[model samples]
Target: MMLRIPLNLGLLLLLCAGGATALAPAEATGAPCGGLWARCLESKCCATPELTCYEKDHRYAQCRPTGNCRPGFHHEDPVQTPWSCVVLTSPAPAPGPGPAPPPAAPAPPAPAPAPAPAPAPGPAPAPAPPPPPQQCVDKGQHCVDWAMAGECEKNAAYMHEFCMKSCNLCGNLFTNSEEGTAAAPAAAGDGSSNHAAGSSNAIDSSLRGGR
Candidate 1:
């Protein structure tokens, strides 16, 4: 019974030590900050009322008064963390589990990636070289030359007829000037031959009458 009493007492003291470690100061002998845990801070030069136990790191860290917090003289907007240095202005209890912080505001939908600018319009491609001129098909040199001189555009039907006839004629197309010159000389020669034949016939007729 005496042995069990002492063992129970030793277990109680061990549990007490573990609980004290949680609220223990950073300068407490063997206690070190681990994981997301931090040890309480003890006021060295500052008073307990003017100071707060903010565990800055695994090691006991000192923070000078920044004068941002009135009368408190510490960071006015202090970051909340396990080991943040803070001033005891009010109780300013640890933040509790509340809303999840709104999921970072959805990142603004990535801005839709702006469409690529359209290419600048170039000169209309030289009108496709005018489709090779329909009159050029199966046409002779003269016909092609006349058509290119815009004659075919002036009268397409007339030029098309002319092209068919001229291409078939190949090279025998007689112009008006050549026909007129040849006809004048041939008509004069025919008249002269008829006159000469008539004079000879008259001479033979007189000779036969005398016989």
Candidate 2:
């Protein structure tokens, strides 16, 4: 019994030293959990003895010590006298691609050509010139000179008279003096010859004097 008491005292002293280290203040010894900085706790009951309450603003925060908050968090009054579990914000998402280009503008339509001008109206044709007068011709007398002088063409009767005068083959030729005056003296004593001479002499004198 005396030897067992000394060995048990040594073991009890070693166990007390380990318990003091394991239960040390969380701020002085960092976190009790290995390497893990702080825990994400929702409930007020933290499993680890070293994990105490912490906060930022008035909400619950991580299980870190006072004044030791994660990035994006500022130390605030503790809702649970030490700390609480409350998330400030989550991470933002990323961006996307882009939009497509617009379609090309349609080409403008061609302009229509101007309509052709209407043809001008033509002047009415002048009335046809009147026909010239027809010339008159001699019958069978062939009076070309009279026709050329415009006399025969002017009057056909004048042409006939002119043709007759120029030919002189027609009408009375000898006077009554040459017919019976000289021959009447030879038979003047006879009653028939004397009457005939008197009639011839009267006719001859009247013709000579143009009476």
Candidate 3:
């Protein structure tokens, strides 16, 4: 069983227990209390004697000087804690007891976390093929025509390397003998361009066209 106490009686008992007066009811009726400068023990009331109960803490309070206290001085004003200044009179007997409080309700469980989403679908990129090697070959009859017509000026980067004999870019590939100069251009040019679809014409005719 639990001990239940009424608010007013509880307050009177609390005040009396702290060093204040004994009669909460009489104090409520505005009765005069002990002389000024007296501790608020039996006479909970301080009357109008220019004094109030100077409370030190929750468990201590006494009648201290009031009005006429010099302003701006900390010690002048005696009232301390914001707790009640008026102590109660006699204690009121409380009822025996009541049923013990019901057992506390248990707390609810926490919620579960949400699941993460799956990754997006797709194929990964493939690696790039390597570049072909640079080889010397005029490529075709067009190299000579392109050189003569100044196609070398418009497409100099390609024309200069491949058409070196006809465009006169690289020094002579064959000896300066008349036969070497005469025979080299036609043979090398015809043998290679069809050998590869790319710029270098690096592959041999045997592998490309089964010649």
Which of candidates 1 and 2 is the stronger one according to TM-score? 2
lDDT of prediction 2: 0.48
Write down the TM-score of every candidate.
Answer: 0.18, 0.20, 0.20
lDDT of 3 at 52: 59
lDDT of 1 by residue, 135-156 (tens): 4233455764464445555766
- Which runs in model 1 stand beyond 4 Å of their true positions? 1-99, 113-173, 176-211
Question: lDDT of each model, Cα atoms only?
Answer: 0.49, 0.48, 0.57
Please give the range of 10 consecutive residues that has the lowest summed lDDT in model 2.
166-175
What TM-score does structure 3 among the candidates reach? 0.20
Best by TM-score: 2
Give the per-residue lDDT of model 3 (tens digit) for 148-210.
Answer: 556667888888777866755444453656666545555555555544355445455446887
Estimate the Cα RMSD of every predicted model relative to the unseen true structure.
20.7, 20.4, 27.4
lDDT of 2 by residue, 125-196 (tens): 999999974333334455544443445446756665655332221234312453443333233336556677
| Model 2 misplaced stretches (Cα beyond 4 Å) | 1-100, 139-211
